[model samples]
Target: QQQVRQSPQSLTVWEGETAILNCSYENSAFDYFPWYQQFPGEGPALLISILSVSDKKEDGRFTIFFNKREKKLSLHIADSQPGDSATYFCAARAYQGGRALIFGTGTTVSVSP
Candidate 1:
């Protein structure tokens, strides 16, 4: 139960539209949740996150809605724009071995004019 799954390898949203990205996990042991956003050729950076204790999180135009019972979560980007186009990764941590994080397959978002 160490798998994080994501859907839609790529998505395109018109400017001002909301971009919805979906993710799910199989590991119930995972307690840390973080969403990472990356531009082309750049390392992923934390965009926003929600602990399993919370059902939702928000930061500016970015928001994450989580369903602990379903083991699912989603990221919503409001006011989509060309500048917002990037690759997003869903990740989780469990303090195992103090190694690193477990990342999802990643979703590439394209905001069109």
Candidate 2:
């Protein structure tokens, strides 16, 4: 079964607008959330992440809004650009000491100019 899930399997946004991606998890053991951005032929790169202790984490134009109680989170890309078009994956790592990260189905975002 899928432990993590993402909504809006695909999304489109105009340049300068914010692109929002939603994610949820079924495992309560998850404590760390990392969002990855992947290009067409490249591996996914860590974009931003948040711990279960915090409600939000922001790095430049990228931000992650997390709600531990609800087992939900969202990634918001501010001032989106065409170069930002790619697939985004929401991944989670449990606190029980496993090195594996459970990833969501992924959300493909297209930033149009």
Q: Pick the candidate with the highest TM-score.
A: 2
Q: How close is candidate 1 to the true structure, as a TM-score?
A: 0.93
Which residue pairs show collisions in model 1?
none
Q: What residue pairs clash in candidate 2, if any at all?
A: none
lDDT by residue (1-113, candidate 2, tens digit) is 99999999999999999999999999998999999999999999999999999999999999999988899999999999999999999999998885699999999999999
Model 2 whole-model lDDT (C-alpha atoms): 0.96
When summed lDDT is taken over every stretch of 10 residues in candidate 2, the lowest stretch is 94-103
Per-residue lDDT for 32-105 in model 1, tens only? 78999999889999999888999999999999999999999999999998999999999987746584689999
TM-score of each: 0.93, 0.97
